[model samples]
Target: MRIVIALGGNAMLQRGQPLEAAIQRENIRKAAEVIARVAKDHEVILTHGNGPQVGLLALQNAAYDKVSPYPLDVLGAETAGMIGYMMEQELYNQMPGAQIATMVTQTLVDNNDPAFQDPTKFVGPVYGKEEAEALAAEKNWSIKADGEYFRRVVPSPLPKSIIEVEMVKKLSEMGALVICSGGGGVPVRKLEDGKLEGVEAVVDKDLTAALLAEQMGADALVIMTDVAAVCVNFGQPDQKKIHKASVQGIGELDFPAGSMGPKIDSCAQFVEKGGRFAAIGSLYDVEKIVTGEAGTWITNEVEGISFYEKKEEAAVA
Candidate 1:
C-alpha cells in the first residue's frame, strides 16, 4: 500500500512543555519508531508540520538585527530540511539497512490569491496582549488575539501543485522511505518568464498532503495528529469521537479551521477525488490505524448505502 502520512506539529513537541532541542529530538525519535514500523509494510511518503519550529526561527531572527530576517517561505523550506534531517537520522537509527530520502519540495500557488490580501493564517510565537500590540505597532503585522495570547497571521494560499510530486512518487516506489512537502511545501508563484518565486504564505500541511495523495495515486492519506480520532463538539460536554464516516457525513460535522477542520476537509477532498480511504488518528497509534483497528476512517461511500447496490448504481450512489 502507498500511504501519505501528514505529521502534526505536536508530534515533535510535548504538550505544555518547553520547546527544547533535546526534547524535540527525543520526540522525533519516538515518532520515527512508529513510522519505521509502517514503512516496513507499506510505501510511505512523510510530510510534517513546522508551526512551532518556524515560529522559533522567526523569534531568533527578531533577537538579532545584524542578520537578514528570513521570510516565511524560506523558513518553511528550511524547516523542511531541518525536520527532514531529524526524521531521516532517527529512522536510520531505528532501521539501519533501510534507505531514506528527503526532498525540499516547492508547491505552486496562485499569485493573485485573495488570501494574500487578507492574511488570516497564524504563525510565529504567542505573546501577551500588551506585547502583541507593541510588536504589531513596531512591525505593522496583522496581529490577532488567540484566546489568552496573540500570534502573527499570514496568508494561507491553496496548493495548486507539488513541484516534486513525480520525484517523490518514484522514490517511494523504489523501496525508499521519502520525506517531502514539509510545512505544507514552500509556497511559490510561477512568474511569466517561467521562473518560480517564493511567496510569503503557509499552505496547510493536511491540504497539501491530500493534493499529493491525489497526484501520486496514493491508497490512503493518513493524518496523524495529537487526537486519537476526530470528535464532534470538541472539548465540550457532548463531544463524540468519530470512528468511521462517509465523506458526506464528515462535511456536516462542526470542526474548527485551525484544529480538526482542515483535516476533515482534506480527507473529504481525497475521497471525492477517487482515493479509497483517509484516516485521522493519534501519532502514537499509527501502526494500529494502518491496520484498520483504529482511527476515524473516511470512505467514499454514503452512510446508508447498501452493499448489494448495482455497480452502476454504486457509482453515483
Candidate 2:
C-alpha cells in the first residue's frame, strides 16, 4: 500500500519541550522507529510541519541583528532540511538497505490569495499582549491573539501545486521513501512569465499534504499528530473521540482552525476525491492506524460518524 504520512511539527517536538537539537533528534528517532516499521512492508511518502522549528529559527535570526531576519520561505527550507536530515539519519539507522530521500520541495500559491489579506497562521513564542504589540511594532510583524497570549501570524495560502511533485512520485515509484514539503514546501508564487519567487507567507502543511497525496494518487493519507484521535466537545465533560466517519460525516463537524481543522478538512478532501481512506491519530500509533485498529478513519465505507468509547479517567490517588 502507498501512504502519505503528515507529521505535525508540534507533535515531533513535543509541546512544552525545549527546542534543543538533541531533544529534537531523539524525538525524530522515536518517530523513525514507527515509520521504519511501516516502510518495511509498504511504500511511504513523508511530510512534516516545521511550525516550532521555523518559529525558533526566526527568533534566532531576529536576535543576530547582523542582517535582517531571513524570510519565512528561507526559514521553511532550513527547517525541512534540518528535520529531514534527522529523520533520514534515524531511518537509515533502522533500515540500512531501504531507499530513502528528502527533497527541498516548493508549494506554489497565488500572490492574490485571500490568505495574504488575512494572516491567521501563528508562529513564534507566545507573549503578553503588551510585549507582543511591542515586538510587532519593532519587527513589523502581525500579531494575533492565541488563547490568552499573542503570537506572530502570517499569511497561509492554499496550495495550488507542488513544483517538484512529479519527481516525488517518480522517486516513490522507484521504491524510495521520499520526505518532502516541509512547512508546506516553502510557499512560493509563480510570476506571469513563469518564474517562481518565494512568498513571504506560510502554507498550511496539512492542506499541502492532501494536495500531494491527491496528485500522487496515494491510497491513504495518514496525519500523525500528538492527539490520539479527533474529538468533538473537546475538553468538555461530554467530549467524544471520533473513531470512524464517512466523508460527509467528518465534513459537518467543527474543529479548531489553527489545529485540527486543517487535518479534518484534508482527510475529507482526500477521501472525497476517491482515496481509499484518510486517518488522523498519534504519530506513535501508525502500526495500529494502518489496520484500522486505532485512530479516526475517514472513508465512504462507514455509514455515519462513529466514536470510540470514552476512556475512563484514572482514579485519583
The C-alpha TM-scores of every prediction are 0.91, 0.94
CA lDDT of each prediction against the hidden true structure = 0.84, 0.88
Clashing pairs in 2: none
Q: Which residue pairs in candidate 1 collide?
A: none
lDDT (tens digit, per residue) of candidate 1 on 239-264:
55666788887777677776688889
Runs with alpha carbons beyond 4 Å of true place in candidate 2: 128-130, 147-149, 311-317
Weakest 10 consecutive residues of candidate 1 by summed lDDT? 304-313
1-317 per-residue lDDT for model 2 (tens digits): 89999998755677667789999898899999999999998889999988778888999998999788799999999999999998899999999988899999999999999999999888766778899999999988899887787889999999999999999999999999999998889899989899999999989999999999999999999999877788889889897878889988888887888778989999999988889999998888888888887888999999889977645111100
Q: Name the Cα RMSD for model 2.
A: 2.5
